[model samples]
Target: MNGCLTDWPGFCRQLQYTGERRLLVLSGEESWAQQQAQALLALSAATSTLWLGDAPAGQPHSPTGKYHTALGREYQHLVFNAFSGLHPDALGASAGALTAGGVLLLLCPPLKLWPGFADPDLRRYVALPEQAAGLTSRFITRFIRIQQADRHVLSWQQGTPFPTLSLPAGTLWQGQQDNRGCLNPQQRHALAVMLHSARTHTPVVLTADRGRGKSSLLGRLAARLLRAGKRIVLTAPNPGAAAQAQAHCPVPLPFIAPDTLLKAPPPADLVLVDEAAAIPVPMLLTLARRHCCVFASTEHGYEGTGLGFALKFQPALAALHPHWRKLHMNMPARWSSTDPLEPLLFRLLALNASPPAPPPAGELNIQWISRQQLLNNDTLLLQVFGLLILAHYQTRPGDLRQLLDAPGMSLAVVFRQRTPVAAALLQREGALEQTLADAIWRGQRRPRGHLLPQSLAFHGGQAQACQFSYERIMRIVVHPDSQKTGIGSQLVHWLKHNTQADFLGTSFGASPDLLAFWHHNRFKLVRTGLAADGVSGLPAAMMLWPLTTAAQTVLPVWQGSFAADLQDEGRNMPGDLPHPVPRVNEQQDRQRAHDLAFYHRDWHADRPALRRFVHRQPPCPSLDEQQQRLLQAALIPGADPVVLAREFGHAGQKSVISALRRIMQCYF
Candidate 1:
């Protein structure tokens, strides 16, 4: 007690230095902090105290003893019991209630609690002190380390009575208004349904195209929750989306960090997540366990994981809660419904746009070639490279290795005279046993042939036998010069007809053309993900085609397994994890923007305007005469001077700016 009391005057002085403001006591019982809080309250009548304990005035059944009445209320001093595990949102809300220059007190572990009680399935990942520090750092201006006790004078039984809090204003959100912003009726409707629904556990999903108002809807719902006196926490791929939602809500306290809300979650009434597809499925599950939450996502866009969303997220949603509602918004919010830009955007994305071509009725002609022979040809490599570059924002040289070495599948190409007209890259992917399947789900990166054994060792949580096989499309490229001649569709038909595997699967960056094309080819919607591939930082869509009746029979079983895991356990269960998609750049830094434009939708023919832009620009060292010829061949209509200069030759910075200015002239 001597050491604890030694800093009494210093504590009072520190509180005085912080001035007459709010104080948050986070479940720690320290003699010094108690004395300091007492001294401060005695000295200044303006200060008030908030006590969060296991048994409150109301809510007797609350597991954490977290009372809802204290939510959204400002307090001069809010303290937690030494053993309380506050809800994350409540912790954030409590922090928000603090005035500027306010002091927050924290104390943890009465020694008697060391090696804290463990559970059968999962132990708490965080501790009380660590949780308190996380909240203090986010909302408080400064922290003064007070004391750490050696042993415990106070003790209580496990689950005796320690309650958490709900912080509605702790999270910071920022975004434009709906009237001044962009959103459609379906998007708005989905959000409203989530907002007005009963507070009981019910999952909700909002899926749409890029610029379709999904994120905006989340912001609107968060605002409604704030006004309803609920403690709401908003999270996204980054702080930008989180802040974007906070801007719409006027809650007094909203939390921003993961630890702030996750460690000691306050009593949260609702949570709104924007760009849900962009977050990894594991993190999404962790948040969803909170009970009442709304997730907004984009389908078949850059930010969404495309097939990952369909194959993974959709089932996860189905298993997330007993009653989950869904809505889709298709119309574009940024451009006109019939804008010509839509077609161009779709082409640039390489999404599901083309239907599969039919097989020859009678016999093989000069235009047709055997799949085995096609694999031997080297000329089709250009199409492969170009398509890969086009579909991804950052396809590295390593991907080329995977394409060349993928398991199974001989290749095929169709030619018009001497030049290569179209091409398709295919592989065998499924029919794996539980061991191998679990490994893939768990995330054991492997080459095509080596996938089985390595996955077996990784997934069983120990060594086990594995047997699985399936055919997958490694890459499918149609020469840009002859894109619309129906070559792309022919490739789809050939793969389905030729593959020996029961199920046919393809994983690639999602784009509008690719999504619609697969849908038309009888490939059902499975998953959606996010990425910054096609200048449309929307999520990608993943779909599957079953080539055999046997495969179809097991498809539902596979789906059931995934759904069960998500509901009962949350996130990836067997060895698979949900990959995160990239988001759109709102800050729009100029350099990153330029790089994004090149990596986005189109690498070769993504240019919107021709003449002024090409001729008046600086050039990259990578572009040579042969590349220039290829570009010229790919450009529609004709390449302009500005288009060439900006896209090809090396001009000075001034010329690049000039070319840019010229391109902007078309929009006007």
Candidate 2:
């Protein structure tokens, strides 16, 4: 192949003739870059092509698709325009979409200054205007260096000759006759495992990097099972993920949402969960218990960290099904094993990254590192950020920008020698101006990034809390291997002792285990959102720890208000609502129980009693377990008497009413 701008057509022809994938790097003026891309697209005999980022006039293209949408799609050619700034995620995702005999063309500014150029995506990193310019990320710099060093990657400049093509030998792997539609040997093995597991009703887990054909394997397995008269239920975090498998299968496969499957499980011989790591572990556990299940997840996915899933979920699976089997697919289904972009993307996004090794069974050295220091140290940054990615279910590329550029954010990490075993990201909160604080309290204004202050003022009804300076623990993660070893507590204690903030607080989706962890750290639940979180489908809980007299003064008010709201909202809950905080004292519990019984029977007469019950705590003897159950059911704003009766082993609603009356007599 000739090496020049005009030679792109010849290069494309050679790539197509060989039936092998190649990456074309075009660097120069934007206009010339587009022209080169156009020439390649015209010459390449691709059935389908996608152009990401802006395209020249008369060019058919789609805007850059977010990395999460990469599943269930393939293309013969992909063009990524990096002039406006390179989106690491889009680059990673678009690379995976190319079929075995395809090409990925990346158009960027001159490679020398590409890293330092102002990126449109940088706007997401900084809050203040001054931090925008002269803010170059090292990740981009490293990416450019990698591109320059690789000889296999074809690079083209404006007036310079295009490098001669060094096409690798061998046609794209088309699977064996018995494994049609499977692109490679690894995928064929995975298909066999899945089919065998389905037939024997043995639980199986499929793990692979992105584009390993795990989803497609599931689809093929489902089709085979369905033909044999076995019902297959397919699910994922969303319908789009499930659709990936459905699209690949020749026959229609019954699909259900993750939550729906958990609530009312349909009859099936096998339940296949695609992107299983993205779905909550609790839901996955429920499905595993009810049906023979198969889970497919990317080993290091853009959607969620499979490392975290393996750490947390694998143990539960072991306990649930002792005979369960796991299969790992290593070969790429869409591209060759030697593709340079794979390693580049993994390092850039820390997709396959792991946290530092655990300390040698000893005390950890904790340190508070400034954001600038973290950014300057590439190895440390990866270790810290990788730990965070493994800890959270929804870490995205935007979070990396925030970590490097966001103001009022601080990082602390516990090191075992040179390895970071645990880390925390803290954000300064509260300290709002009086006007802004009052407006927030009155629901007239909302601010970005001030989660604690805004949530307290508006949601908890603590108007003055916005004025008090506080520290919000944004995220804290201990290495899975080192958890329950007190490293997390040590980090928290270090923050409290070192910082002069008036208080400390944190919030997260409420779960029994998570709530207990916060409570163990001495944080009191101050508020709980009525609506379940859109992502986790669980209610959010906010907890606070007072460190000063001023903070102490407001803590009780917030706690009391939260309790009252919980009493009112629990009734509408579908099932039993876990108490957000510790239960009240015996005296308060008795008074609350009495008021709830009266309110349940006749609210008009007991309205005044309810008011007194919330406002004051009086002296009284402790109530029995039955009395406590009555109080919980009756105080729940819309609790059904019949449901309460059944829950408490009563004969009927009449029996529940009689039991409530007996409990109320002592209070009266």
Candidate 1: segments with Cα more than 4 A from true spot: 1-184, 198-200, 250-264, 353-668
Q: Residue-wise lDDT of candidate 1 within 199-230, one digit each (tens)? A: 65576777766545565456667666677677
- Scored by TM-score, the top model is 2
* lDDT by candidate, in order shown: 0.43, 0.71
Task: Identify the candidate with maximal lDDT.
Answer: 2
Residue 365 CA displacement from its true place in model 1, Å: 14
Q: Residue 426's C-alpha lDDT in candidate 1?
A: 56
TM-score of each candidate structure, all chains considered together: 0.33, 0.75
